[model samples]
Target: MADDPFQSRFAADASLLPHMADLANDRVLVALLAEADYRAASFLDQRLLTDRVGREWMAWDALPDLGAAAAGPHFIFHIGHVGSTLVSRLLAEVGDVLPLREPMLLRTLAQVAERIERPESVWSPELYRTRLAQTLGWLGRGFAPGQRAMVKASSVITAVADDLTGSDGRALFLHVPLPRYLETILAGEASMAETLAQAPARMARLAALLPDFPHALWQLPPVTRVAMSWLCEMATAQRRLPPDDPRRLWVDFEAMLADPAAALMAQATHFGLPIDPARIEAALAGPIMRQYSKAPEHGYTPDLRRELQAQAAADHAPAIAEAIAWVEALAARYTNLADLPILGDQSVIQEVRCSS
Candidate 1:
């Protein structure tokens, strides 16, 4: 055996990926990407990468087959509610851009495809990995071979990024929750309360199932789910307070109202996103902002009222009281963008994010 030539080639950079991938383990991928510096600052497109590899590299596992594609690079991604809609809409304004929404279905598919055990929940793991690749494939298929796709993802399936296939596609991931958003989170406890009322009660249950996944790639999702659990718990406590008692929440709605764009912009920038500061300011000036306005019949729920009354004592009560006051104080700050089209453009689904 002259030093096992086949084994050596198997782990070689090219085969290393598919081989390690076949092992049903995502560790190699994680280590490689973290080392690659996804957070590095850059304004240039990856035109040179095409020269190095001869052809473009779309994502490995997630993309659709679009048959024929247009020219230029693409931006794809996953994002939460934190100013992402604004960023995506703005990015769409950029020429030659084909943006994808949450990409939730693909996310579920990836989880199912390479996951250790199939998930029996909302997502279909069996179809996860390839579907995302298929999406990239389809998106890329519509473009030239060397075109790049800047994709923003909803449920971040970074492990599946390399697996995505199509034209030459490289991804830049941005974590949109920034300092201002965190401050708002810390300050606006009532908002948290409101979030709880609206969020699914099953969220807490989902956080506990992380250990069941096959690969470390699956761990990231639960980190988010776990955080949700804490917020939901805190919210449950906040809902128990009386209207007058303060300390139920964290931040102020009045201040948030005065500078909606400013507050939102801080969140956008915090995630290393590229957003126009001027537009952020413009967004605030338009009427219809804040969590929700107070209407006599269309106000707080019974679950909330009881939660507040029950929490009037002990440690949780004060936090909730403060939050309620914070929400009440800013009642005038909200404009309910639900009616206003995105960026003031009411067209196909591309420009609209109207409220329910």
Candidate 2:
């Protein structure tokens, strides 16, 4: 490495992780991150980039390209509040995995991807593709030779899942049934506020997919607004990683909670990671399971989550029923949404007791 902090050791070292891609400014913010730093931080966004972390911004073109030879940089794409962080934590604990949770750079790229074809787009198609490859190469670097870099993307990043993942790239699409998803989001004031705030953008994305998407964001109540969020994300996943795709694995978060060790083992195999049953067992029994994944100091467990969901469901039963009916109506009208494995499987929904 050179004396210059931003001297472009992106290809050679995993420490210089690209923290943010400022497309408007044509620069990338790179941060020096160690194994401990990656493990300690919940998200690799501006929140985690404290004054203590060494960082600098470099022009986009100045970044060295590692080309198409970068190693495994698989992904975990999930609907929000579905234990995606927990999955990332468990994988990180099992070894041979370099976990990068919600890196803001990817979010920037996803936003750029949404407008790449538009007349007013900042990046031309060629530059966007090149930068996407370069960013992935930078993210693919690992502390050890065989350690695979696994990114658990922010929920909305699913909008560009197809663009981010190559044909050979493997991804786990984590989600829960619609009713459970509503319960989880509606249970928290912050989560509900986020859902409402993001509803318009999500509705726009959903309209792009389903040309006849009928309801406006203003037309829907709070509960259905949350349902629309699920539909938009889950539909994006369905379109991007179809069931026939060999590189994609679909994992239900509820099923994972039921049998975590087995779920972890299966997920490891899906990503071609080396399996250590002992390590998986240790992770399940470890502190990560007991602590809130996004904030380790806060204690949160599956039992607590269930209690919250139950209370939310009971308190808002009428609104929830209306939201479910709204989704069911859409599913019936749209062939693409009709056969969604989560929506179609009554046994799965019934097992969760989402319908009483």
Best by TM-score: 2
Cα error, candidate 2, residue 81 (Å): 0.6
lDDT of 1: 0.32
Q: How well is each residue in 162-267 modelled by candidate 1, as lDDT tens digits? A: 4552334333332221222222333346644544443343243222322242222233232232234333232222222211233111212223333445545543
User: For model 2, what is the alpha-carbon lDDT of residue 79?
Assistant: 84
TM-score versus the correct structure, for each prediction: 0.33, 0.95
lDDT tens readout by residue for model 2, 203-222: 99999999867888989998
* Model 2 ranges off by over 4 Å: 1-8, 342-356
Indicate the worst ten consecutive residues by lDDT in candidate 1.
Answer: 26-35
Predicted candidate 2, C-alpha RMSD: 2.5
